[model samples]
Target: MTTDSKRKGIRLPRPLAIFVWAYMVWNLLPVVAAMAFSFNATRSRSQWQGFSTQWWSGTPLSLFDNEEYTAALKHSLELAAMTTVISTVLGTLLALVVTRIRGVAKRPVNFILMIPIVTPELILAVGLYLSLTFITVWPFSVVELGTPAQVVGQVTYTVGFVVVIIRGRIAVLGDGLEAAARDLGAGPIAALVLVLFRLLMPAVLVGAMISFAFSIDNFVITQYLSSDSSTVSIPMYLYTNARGGNTTPALNALATVLVVTTLLAVALASLLYRWATRRESVASDVTGTVALSA
Candidate 1:
């Protein structure tokens, strides 16, 4: 009964497998319908008349120019890029600082950063909106928020998630690698360049991608902080179009693009990380064998 298994002996439970399939179907049903409807010839999303790609082609063009899908896409991309750069820089610094901390202060700092992550988005959005009010601080008019301020506000909440993710990676990367490099006469910066940066690169990249996706899909925070119609992102565009007795096929098309892009990037990142880990594991095993033989 205890025979060797070539497949690593890992197996999903029957009930668990059933549940996973059911869950996937439930979650993907709407997405699947949207994608299918994106290609439908009819204007109505409910009826499956026939297949056409007009939504994909000439999207937001002559027929759909009023939707503002093109402008909204540009806005979302710009906002996502800004959020990614700011969050990645801030989060990486947080991870680096966390790695250097070895005392009681670490827990409190981490808790404070993580508190925003666990807080409900609705509550956070409302709080951010209230805080932006013209209520006087020291009798002077408070700094009024615009699109840039909205991005900053959202990034504040986003940095917390990024920090937690990168911190976990940094924690796993113990001090031994840096110690070895230093013992070999490298300076602190040199040691970090030679040891720490290479090891934590994958985690940092993954964290950045996650932050980018979150920033792009963010609705509640952006909704609360949003000021001008010009600041409208793709999510906000989709929201208003979905409501207000308006239904555009371009929204479906945009959803398809978002889902595909997100999935592709995530899949590529996962594969890269797995391949790197596998190579490292194999190299370590080979080195261990050589050392044992010696």
Candidate 2:
């Protein structure tokens, strides 16, 4: 224990600590194995011959050079970008509406919005696929089984998560700032953009990060909605070739790329969140000091 922890008498239970470590190891072992074998000199995933960067670079079968792997990665990124933008905007608006609305209807509306999150991915995918295939109505008729469909499917599920996150932030923030902004002669839209939205920026970034992460790793929806080879994503590519007899360490390298991409995005989001919150704190402190002086 550290000095602070010791002083506070905060000793972690021995068995619980061991169990947590063990659980982490168990969950991470396969991912670690995959990443390690991606650098193997040979093609065998089970047996690591030696350390080499062949799968990551140099050859045609390498992650970046390989057409299939590159295409999949690109598609995954495109989907993630689209889904994140759309879901964040829509979810933020929905959360704002949900939080502001009063009375008995609010509970039902909130529950309705949460339906997509609670629905199973496979079922959701199947429903979207069937609807897009069979329903020839205006909007559904215009949409097809490709990137557009993938975006729609991803956004549907991802919006719920964004709503949940933004709503939690809204709950903590309350309506005081917005009310004050109104009292200061700011219009409703101005109050939203200048006061409330500034405070909610951290939550928006978090929602975008979650949406991107979910979209990038999404398999069932992407798979069901794919029209052809061009629409295949990284997750789809990995599923197709991971157990193949002719598969190489290149597959592992691709998986590593996906993992690294997600980690980088998460790191970036965390930094942004910290920056935003720090600004909010500083602004609040300044306002408090000014009020006290007055």
* lDDT by residue for model 2 (95-208), tens: 999988899999899899988889999999999999999999989999999999999999998999999999998988999999999999999999999999988999999999
As a whole number from 0 to 100, the lDDT of residue 242 in candidate 2 is: 85
Best by TM-score: 2
Off by over 4 Å in 1: 1-9, 59-67, 135-144, 284-294
Predictions: Cα RMSD each = 3.5, 3.8
> Any runs in candidate 2 off by more than 4 Å, and if so which?
1-10, 279-294
Which 10-residue span in candidate 2 carries the lowest summed lDDT?
1-10
All candidates' lDDT scores?
A: 0.76, 0.92
Q: What's the residue-level lDDT of 294 in candidate 2? A: 75
Superposed by TM-score, candidate 1 places the C-alpha of residue 146 at a distance from the truth, in angstroms, of: 3.3
**Model 1 agreement with the true structure over 1-294: per-residue lDDT tens digits:** 112243267789999999999999999998899878888886777788898878766644322454477667777778788988899889888878876777899889878878779999889878777776655673223545557656776787788877877777777777888999999999999988778888878777777777788888888888777778878877887777775445756678877767776776677767766765677767866776678677
What TM-score would every model get versus the actual structure?
0.87, 0.91
Q: After superposition, how far is residue 112 of candidate 2 from its true place, in Å?
A: 1.7
In model 1, the clashing pairs are: none
